[model samples]
Target chain A: MTTGVRRRMGVEERREQLIAVALELFSHRSPDEVSIDEIAGAAGISRPLVYHYFPGKRSLYEAALRKAAEDLAERFEEPREGPLGARLLRVMGRFFDFVDQHGPGFSALMRGGPAVGSSTTNALIDSVRQAAYEQILAHLGITAPSARLQLVVRSWVSLAESTALLWLDGRRVPRAELELQLVHDFAALAAVSAAYDEEMASVLRRILADEPSDGPFTDLVTRLVGLAPLPGSV
Target chain B: MTTGVRRRMGVEERREQLIAVALELFSHRSPDEVSIDEIAGAAGISRPLVYHYFPGKRSLYEAALRKAAEDLAERFEEPREGPLGARLLRVMGRFFDFVDQHGPGFSALMRGGPAVGSSTTNALIDSVRQAAYEQILAHLGITAPSARLQLVVRSWVSLAESTALLWLDGRRVPRAELELQLVHDFAALAAVSAAYDEEMASVLRRILADEPSDGPFTDLVTRLVGLAPLPGSV
Candidate 1:
């Protein structure tokens, strides 16, 4: 009976409400197909009111993208107290979950992340990637990772993103299996980078030292370093 | 030049010509941006003539995609002689080269390879991926690759593709180093997969047995294993 009179939300709350509506619409439809009127109607607000908070559709889309990127960045941030592998797996699990929940919206934001957007939008996406890289390093307890360590981590991050996209686009394998494979790829890259970079060699030494001998990492090192009763054991 | 006296090309050649022109145009613009008129005009042909060979603009775009996919698939195949690592390095080199040449077009075709495209177009793209996977196994001489082996290779292919796209999108690392990193990834994955699948474990043994001393592969295994490394790892 009192439906005509609505409670007024603060500026931040209003902006967030609009973005949430826009994000949901964008998840189901391409950006071009989703209109401001639809967004306003979906939020039960006037078109002019939607414009008051955001200048235009592009800006609103950018905000939505940044929100997604922030969600991902936050998910990537975990306590760096656990064993590096377990910590990475947890982060990866959260990442997969985010991908599952966000599906199409995640694809829209990440597909051509920097390609179809402005430099500012691109930088926002880059920030998410950088945040993930830094979190992984922190989990490994590396305060000053070397150039090779940096490259390996950077490339591996790209690989993880690509894998995530491919999974969302295809008949995705089991999430646990995919997450395990990513960790294995990171470990492999660490060992591989060590072959070419002295800093990486030291990093791998630490990784090897931290790992249990009967673990997957240990078995991986054993298989790669075949004919070994465990090297660097002297 | 004999103006207005163009030589008559066969239907296949004419279609190839039209597709080539479309591919070049799509390279610099999105599929929606490139028009049927522009494609025909660019090829110095009439609009109806362009449509004569293809049903519509979407079909034309699909043809362009198929062309790029074929180009990439061709580049990934290489003579599978000599060391496996060396052979892989060669294939990666070609892949990087292809990416460098077709940066935008490659991205266009691959950005959503199977995402938004029609099933036929998606199938064209899938065919390329399947071809690359088969070629990789061929290089390894695996006639009947186990499920784990298939999974590892399939994931690696996805990784390679993602890396290529990232390289094109971002500041690219040096070709040799990036290629080496991929090789390392494949080798490491093989070892890791072996932990879960006995077939992979046996594959690693054969890989180890084939690698020669005083080579990069030998050095890699030694450095990864660390310590004495089985005296040249023979």
Candidate 2:
């Protein structure tokens, strides 16, 4: 544990170290503004070694973004066994906390740039979104998923991300107050699942009470009634 | 109109013409990709004249954005005499249609370089958001609004914008379906106002039943509960 011990590190450790340093620097300045030389200087390593780890600034930024996305995914995955609404709140609470702790880095990544606007980073975000959607479906016990369900999930995620950004932007509300408001908003939105079920049941009852149907109109009405709320409803 | 007649216009008409041309060009290309010279060329005017009108590409973009913001404000100011939920939906429907018609131009302004990052442009967006918030408060008959209410409106706006973008991205859902879903979702969220009022009413009833004294807790609860739901709640 001596100051000069200089413990040898693994290749993976060095790569992570480079990404961490790069993320820290990218937060204060735009990607174009930060140079590999500065990253190397900050990390107490030679420029060549930094290159050996990341190949270039673009690659480094993408890697950092991927790492952060993974971290977020893991956070959401942690509280998976609770009631649907409570679980969602827990996951969102963690997410807001992450934004608060890493405000600059999250903002930089969320505000994408040209160099890092590749399919890789997008797929990373999509993965997180898809995972959350699947969790909601499972919690709801939705036997057959529909396109409407997908839209709802996407909309909710979009709302959560935008709200986090606003909260980060020095909105006057405290985090606890924001969290309470979100719980109410999100829970009410989620209640649409029950409402949709009720509406569908009523449509079915009316159809059954009617004379034999002649066309596809009855089926269409049933399907429509069962459809999920649109994206961003919540 | 003859060519000469159209060409000879007042300064205000010419400035408007320049902004229209700039908005058109911005729709076709990223803001950074479009140049002042190109805007001038597209407008059938000299670069110096374009500069005389807009000063630079940034200024030109800002002007176009301001025009869009003003249009939105005007739409929001339209008569909203109806149930609160219906009124809110009508206003949002107008917004969605506007975004649909001006998809590319709005996208350019929202996600464009410098436009998204510029403080001035962000301020313009904030101002538009404030106007929308005010309209929501007026519709709900909520006096002395809380931060929570503002957050709800902001969240709803974000949701509406995100939904419009998804539709513009060519999602399979029809605009009619999206609109219906939004209405249902909004109605559900708006229902929370009733719950808030009910909670306050119960607190008052309890306070009055227990003692004749109006304690601070009773007064606080009374004030909280007296906050009515947006009109039209059962």
Candidate 3:
């Protein structure tokens, strides 16, 4: 190792550097598999310095978890100024990027199994989803979403999470194709919800009308129409 | 204890009895929580008798897992002599019943994490899904499904598993309503697939036409219309 002079950094900068190192380690392996020594070693610092920023491994892990969650939530806060379908596509692209950036950690957070995950990590993960739900409602221009709409959005998120987790577990097609398929599934589920409730129906109708003809939403609905039975046939 | 009646049974009967007893215990607790003595006691037999059927806890767990899979697969094999929607509803009803009957064990099996589950359990779980896929294909009268069809069905199964798992974990509405919602989701996914693939679209169109007006398929399609934007609106 080059024994160059270590640059003095601010407290926040040091903490950020530690968290970044921890995130990289945890991304490829479970938190249990990562050691504080390894993290410090990778960052060219001492274990005591690591504990100064984090009380222990759990805190360090949670810090990394939050950073990842914050990163994901911030990404989802994309510009909502475009066609609704285009906006959703951008949001989906962020979701894909999160998976690409974090790799196994993304799957671990999404899995939420008790062995390698803590309640704190799970809550952080939930907040990320909650952020997505709020962003979706904000995009839809609904300040206070109806209860049914809330459930619909939340269920879709869970579905998306499971699908992505399974894909990351090696049941993957091309990432682009799967992400597009996810966008279609989201639209399809919204349509299903609108079918059973008038509130949802109007909400979905308004959402669809906000999309352009060339957007993915149009492609999704148009395709569904052909699979639909001939008019009056049923 | 009154040791008056130990029935003379065949080897298969005795093994089945032991597995049934073990399954009852496993339904509420993971395999590690269920002791060999408890399983033998539950079966009204001695510890050595349990060992006679299975060498250890892992083997007993495997046997119970196989029994549950068999029971579920058999249930999905309902008579294929009805309206396609009716047949699908019956199959879905069986899926719901399996969850209800097996309870927590169903969730654990579907979760398939490394803690309590192994490669064997995971494979058994996949076999359960495989059986459903075959049953669905048989119901559709398609002897040889295309590659795309296989992916579509597998993905739908994964979605259904996630939905059921979330419901069982207590994010549930009324049991009947959620099951109906699941049926709708399945139809919607098929419609999504049909949009891009001509074979799937034709298959879905035919299936939709076979449903009665009062069925969930009709309700689902009808609801979708209200949510669908007018063709020229986009």
Candidate 4:
């Protein structure tokens, strides 16, 4: 292992290796609790060499965060095929997969850990959220989102975030149900918005038109019907 | 005012005065931006006199935050009457009213400003959220909340928080609509959970039984029906 550490490696390879090591370490414990020395030891490199690749623990944490953010953002990207509800459920599965895999790091990034209030850290998290929002818009096939539509999308994004954070505290709720519930949550948010705004109503209409009879949205409707029949409906 | 400041006062009175002054200053701007001298000036007292009452700015901020937290927790208190929807709408109104009045302070409190990640601050905010959850459960007239019921209530609390934070960024939507929308968001969140768990379904049934035809929950059901009529109905 020592010989392997001494083996020739390109600069980019060395940086990526260090980031991977840091990410693995940060995954279990908070970035604050993890030390640069521990990272160096895990990477089988000297402390000086670790600093050679990254300036400090804060920088390394940000790099790892950026990587996690990118990976998490990609999770939100599902193929455009299939019903909207199914696509969202698939996206949520991958989203929670990332959250489960990168529990502490995800919490730190979302809850503002070492770089609390840091603009760069904020921008990275915002980018991931933006990616999710844009992906939803693309799925909706809406070129321009109305104010209410934007609100609905942003609110769902926040809901998913808070839900994941709370779930991370204890794995009490089953992950699978939470994933489908999130898909339903997205529809629930949009449905409420649709009731208030004509633009949102049209958006919801287009979404429902594409959904199948057994999708998560339909499941939500089925559950709602069990509570009470819609008044004035035959 | 300056002469009044020079007059003798009880120590507790002076301390309370300082906290109030700091809170007023922090309400407009982030606590980090506010200064001890400014707090003193606002209270018509010298900087040293301000120090005489409080140890430092951080302590003063915490004191002010405690006050804000108490006030915010109180906002969730609504007499259980009429219907849950109207009661929740009233709670949301008061919640947003506090948000509107204490924009920066509210942001700081929720987003972890000045004392970012401080346990005291975190506990204070958590206490407020806990208060909200308990108040909601009390309104539902439930002593033992199921896991799904807990999830629904907690998720609604988080939704309300993010909604207020976003609304504070830009007063885009009408306040009245946002308030009602938050109520709808709560019902929507609960509705989704109620669909999943039988425990939640019964909770929903009891809630619906008391709600009037024109209540927000009924409004949500009406809106949902507009999207797509439930299949095999009638």
Return the number of clashes found in candidate 4.
0
**Candidate 1, position A211, lDDT:** 65
lDDT, candidate 3, residue B211?
81
Q: Deviation in angstroms for A5 in model 4?
A: 8.9
Off by over 4 Å in 4: A1-5, A113-117, A232-234, B1-5, B113-117
lDDT of each: 0.75, 0.60, 0.75, 0.84
Better of 1 and 4 by TM-score: 4
Model 3, position A80, has a per-residue lDDT of 67
Candidate 1 on B143-188: residue-level lDDT in tens?
A: 9987667777877887787667666665445667878778877877
lDDT of 2 at A199: 36
Q: How well does model 2 score by local distance difference test?
A: 0.60
iRMSD values, candidates in order: 6.5, 15.8, 4.1, 2.3
What TM-score goes with each of the models? 0.70, 0.66, 0.75, 0.94
Q: Write candidate 2's Cα lDDT for A161-225 as tens digits.
A: 77777677666667754554455555444434323444333332332334123222222222222
Error (Å) of candidate 1 at residue A173 is 5.8
Ranking by lDDT: 4, 3, 1, 2
Q: What is the TM-score of chain A in candidate 4?
A: 0.94
Cα lDDT tens digits, model 3, B102-165, are 7788776665544345557767777988898888888877887764466667666766676676
Query: What are the per-residue Cα lDDT tens digits for candidate 4 across A48-126?
Result: 9999989998888889889988998999888888789999988999999989998977786677633543667777888
Q: What TM-score does each model's chain B reach against the true chain B?
A: 0.85, 0.73, 0.90, 0.94
| Weakest lDDT window of 10 consecutive positions for candidate 3 chain A | A110-119
List model 3 lDDT by residue over A99-185, tens digit each. Answer: 877888776655444434545765787798889888888887788765556666777776667666656766435667667777787
Off by over 4 Å in 3: A1-4, A7-19, A25-66, A79-83, A104-127, A137-151, A165-174, B1-18, B28-63, B79-83, B104-123, B137-150, B169-172, B206-219
